[model samples]
Target chain A: MDLPGIVHRAGGALLGTLQHVRIPGVGQASVTDDPATSARRWRAVTVLRDQAAVGTPEAPPPPLDRFGDRIEVRLTAAPADRGTELAARFRGTPSEAEIGELRAALREAKQLLEVGEVLRVDPQPHGQRKPTPQGAALEGMTEQAPKEGVL
Target chain B: MKAATWTGVNEVSVEDVPEPTILNDHDVILKIRQSVTCGSDLHLIGGYIPFMRAGDVIGHEFLGEVVEVGKEVRDRKVGDRVVVAPFAACGSCWYCKQELYSLCDNGNANPGITEGLWGQGVGGCFGYSHAMGGYAGSHAELMRVPYADVGTFVVPEGVSDTRALFASDAASTGWMGADLAGTEPGDVVAVWGAGGVGQMAARAAMLLGAEQVVVIDRVPERLTQVRTHVGAEAVDYTTTDVVAELRERTGGRGPDVCIEAVGMEAHAPGTPGIYDQVKQQLRLQTDRPTAVREAITACRKGGTVFTLGVFAAMVDKFPLGAAMNKGLTLRGAQVHAQRYIPELLRRMEADELVTEHLATHVMPLGEAPEGYRMFKEKDDGCVRAVFLP
Candidate 1:
């Protein structure tokens, strides 16, 4: 790979590692669940709407429902006045890419249900992008941001 | 179209860039009227944030005219002069409903980056880094504002563009610190750092009925502005002991409310300052908490210490013990501008809050490189450099 490409991948990998590393006395709040356990864990988003509006597990919103048979969804009332807790998990162990897709989907579903549109940041105005490795790494980090958080 | 961008650390450049367009249904395209250099921008420019990319547009506090509004935008329309909230928050979120718009869950598009850094992602900011959602900033001829109906407030007809410009971030952020810290009438309030936000916080405290408001700073020009413009007493921290001064001025009780407007890059005069600078340079800590520590120490027992400043990740040598033992209410948040902008505009319209003095230097967008330099160095007594895009 070219230098920028290598740096870019490293940036994304760095983000992935950040979520699992636990150094005592620092930012040590990351969850270090094993891959299998993580795959089975239900990722949820609290949407500010009624549970009925969020639909049932078998008939969840667009992005969450798109997971279909591969995932088992759950919808419950979030603590008083907060809204509905929409959650889902893969029935079987899934690849890292699939988990990332679910993360992005959950976020999108929340935005769609609340704001009626997913917030877009790309195709926006910017200055020249010099092919510096640091800039490329930030690009890679942002590109992986949607899929790499604790959620 | 032209925009000023972060070319590199401590480097800003003006170059041809694409004009922003409506991306979301609630978005609006703005013709930026006035964008100012904030003290927080200095941290990003100095690379303390470490999230800014080269060529990324870099500004947040601004005033603009709505040139185009998305289909779903109801309150704002084309030709409306508005001051945008620094953080883009969706009004429907639980956080927004609770008047904590800065913590809106739906605002940040790039969540994982900040989530990994801070454990939870906050809202996105315009022209802030990619970690803040990579939104193009207002330091351009044209820019995009998301969730316009919630984030953009119409400028009162009686308020000048210069006066309304700061209501976007500085004034709102300062007001949040004072109002949220529970500043009460007859309370003695002490604020650290007399920058734009610090000055505004002092003014807000006075407006909220603080009996005696004192602003602490080492900068002579800023201190002068504090006494002359803000009508608050000023302390030169370089000469006076901040903790001792606060206690002495408050009749041995210290201040009821202490607000820190100086962020991670706080300046100190002695060994503590040098130690923090060296530690931050070596990456032992992400922020220098000089002002925060002083605030905690200077606050009265059971008093409130509010951090209006921004801190990245972690800080070494924090005075958690003092804060805990003193029964202090320690709190901090990014600007909940949406919650305060409307009232701030009303105050501005009434000429009760004047911010035109904050614009120490006004220049065109193309002069942003020089403007940032002057503002960063505090050269020519520059408090804020307002850019006319």
Candidate 2:
């Protein structure tokens, strides 16, 4: 559908506004609109890793070393909210290629469903047992036979 | 200088005293060439442990040569080197049968045991007052030990008497605290207090496979010792907000286990001894001193809190409801000295654990008063003070 113009514009504008600039302080960051619920949701992650800061001349931050392995991220959204933003956190633990692949997979899943159609995103496809109801709607649901109990 | 006695508060002396002979067929007369004062000994002199009086021998944890043994005691010899686990058990009661000998059921095991001492008909202890179980301690040149066969462990070769002494009480208590806290690899463990027992618990946690151990202490020297030797991180609870610090360290989930090594004297005069009700108190709030509280507050959901310290004689209340609410299991116990000695000694023999590092000062038995003062004030990195009688 030769829509490079629209896709690049959306990606570029979002990237420019979000790059490297952190809020003065983020209070109560929620993975979902209601973080109280344990379901899939769109997530916000912050860049906390700074390999350059360790053993450097700075006095070290009070909340220091929360970089790299200690980097923080949270997920939000649910099958009831629609599967459009399922496993947004899956990108945080992957390489560049893996993240691109995950993004493409989410896009494909979104497209496979009708606009506003419901879908269940298995938050941890690799985890053993049960698909999270995510934001799936019963109608227009692409129910694949669950693979023999996450085995 | 062959015998020890309490002359006054913070005063002790060695005098020409009668030597001990086996009274029971199960008894052993140990010629104590070495002995030591514990922090609890201060309780006896200051009258804090309650019901202690003049002529009471001082010290509880020590190692020595077995000078004589009765006909019923078969395992030990006159010359055999042994480390004593001062707590005794009846070995047949429900608690003892389950290998929980420290909680043994005996006629004297009851609260009314002020008739004489603890464990007289049930189980007994060493070096504590008549309220505890009127048994003489090892901090003397001569001492009589009832139930000697069950309480003393033979020191294996190459494990010096210097090192084996702690297998009696401090080291075992620490190991049991870590064990009760359910330590596992990759878990974060926080121990409150850096006393002899606290540091030992930290070391035991490391040996049992905890990935990180955070030892909380106001005493700088003791904390430094723990950080340098046991690989445990340190927390100066005096200035730092301990609760916030622990939460920050543990992925906001809290430590996997928290051990209370501070027992009663976590704060000053009002609180005393180890805690039995900390099992209940831990349910209320997690805090620094009453490590049981901190353990409850600091543990991850579905974690374990072990109280190894002895609480004073008040039926204090704790948060049993919180423990249940948080889905936590809290265990209360005194050290099972009868059982853990051999296993602990093997670790020492293999050089896998060096408990002697805990012994920071040593003096002749006459200076036990000085030893008592140093340990009570916690001077000179005073984790342990050994008395060579």
Candidate 3:
């Protein structure tokens, strides 16, 4: 499988590489209008797929439409040394349109520019992921509505 | 009925194991379909475990085909495929009622005694040593269990042996570790041992939602397996200061919960070369509790420390001060194997968990001694070795 592509980043745990940058009209709206960050600069959810090869040979790397790749996001507040985790919504997959943006966004997002393994596609899926029926094509696992007012 | 006795450490001459006859209405005879070794079995070999005698059938982890049941036993039958819940508990004891079967009162000297109740006491384990209930273990093809219906669990259909085999001990022990750790969603949890039990704890911790999981061990191959399969950040304690590394990963707070999977023979320096001088002595000291020390020191302040590994006897001079000062919670014990088996089976059915990777080595029962040595030496990826007897 390809290395886990960076879905997005911000502060604290989100402090690493700017792995992907999703800014398509729908993705942008998803990030800009998320309830979690309705009044913030960016409320984006960037998913870190366990591998570059999530679904099948033909399946897309995540942030797919089914799982809500349209995430809320935010750029970290200044002072890189402050060490706040940068986080993003870890759901869904990216469209073909966003993969390119993801690469560019990663180049622009590297805070240190020295973290060795930038990106690599995986040959197989790892862990508990299910394969999409159509070879590698996938819609990604849908997010369940949080049960009864819970996370 | 010929009773089986401990021959020497692990060498049991099953030539004269007693044929158990009906006792209480709850007794059942098990024609063992599968019997095997446990890490606790190692305690006997190391002579670290207490109460052991020569000629005891040394095994507590096994599943059986029930050949007979007592008049009082109704739920189980002659043809049932069952896994013994290593810890025996009387069905209605206080601990049994509360579901803490391992701590049952009215406890017998046999490890499989079933007087279930809350026990903050120090006592027995089945088929292990003299200290625990000294009931003969299942190294042979047949044995008997009292309170059979309550203590024996059914292995689910369609679940492979690789999955169900550990339900009796290793899997549940790991679950105990994760549960005691109070795993939180998105919490950073670090598991200190990557044996069968440690791997399960890490996976269980993930099922509970630890955002970043780290596994520390000395074996390069084992660390690789955990990283490639479970995706926990790997730390080779031999090459790095585990406590310092965990602090660096967690921004100095360390893991929310730290689990000690290495148990009594916790080798302090990960790479495993120097013989522990303490192991040479009968008495255990702070230096003897290497893994315990690592686990305690590595845990985040205010975090929970779970000891899934079993020590022969309690050790001394623990950084209990750290536990008290850090306000950390410490919990240790052999697992209540029966309590968690059904839930684990359900998760396995749902495709939510898989334990197949843990079987780094599998051999026929004839190589049982070799399997034990390899495991003790931790050669290759011998994290867990299963004997297909």
Name the candidate that leads on TM-score.
1
lDDT scores of the candidates, listed in order: 0.92, 0.59, 0.57
Where does the lowest 10-residue lDDT sum fall in candidate 2 chain A? A142-151
Off by over 4 Å in 2: A1-151, B7-11, B106-111, B114-122, B268-289, B315-317
Report the C-alpha displacement of residue B306, candidate 3, in angstroms: 1.0
- C-alpha TM-score for every candidate: 0.99, 0.65, 0.66
lDDT of 1 by residue, B1-389 (tens): 98999989889999999888778899999899999999999888999888888888889999999999999999887999999999999999899999999899999999998888778888999888888888888899998999999999989788999999999999999999999999999999999989999999999999999999999998899999999999999999899998998888888999999999999999999999999999999999889999999999999999999999999888998898999999999999999999999999999998889999999999999999999999989999999999998
Clashes of each: 0, 33, 70
Q: Write the per-residue lDDT of candidate 1 for residues A1-151, one digit (tens) a residue.
A: 4888899988888887777778754445477777888789999999999988888987989888778899999988999899999998899889988988999999999999999999999898888998888888888898998887888
Model 2 misses residue B377 by how many Å? 0.8
Instruction: For residues A1-151, write the lDDT of model 3, one tens digit per residue.
Output: 3312212111111211111214331121122234334322221212222222122213322322232345433334324322222233333444422332332332222211211122111111111222323111111100000000000
Q: How much does each candidate deviate from the true structure in C-alpha RMSD? A: 1.0, 27.4, 25.0
Over B157-221, each residue of candidate 2 has an lDDT whose tens digit, in order, gives 98988778888888888888888677988889888878777888888889888988999888888
In candidate 1, which residue pairs clash?
none
lDDT of 2 at B58: 62
Who is ahead in DockQ, 1 or 3?
1
Q: Flag regions of model 1 displaced more than 4 Å.
A: none
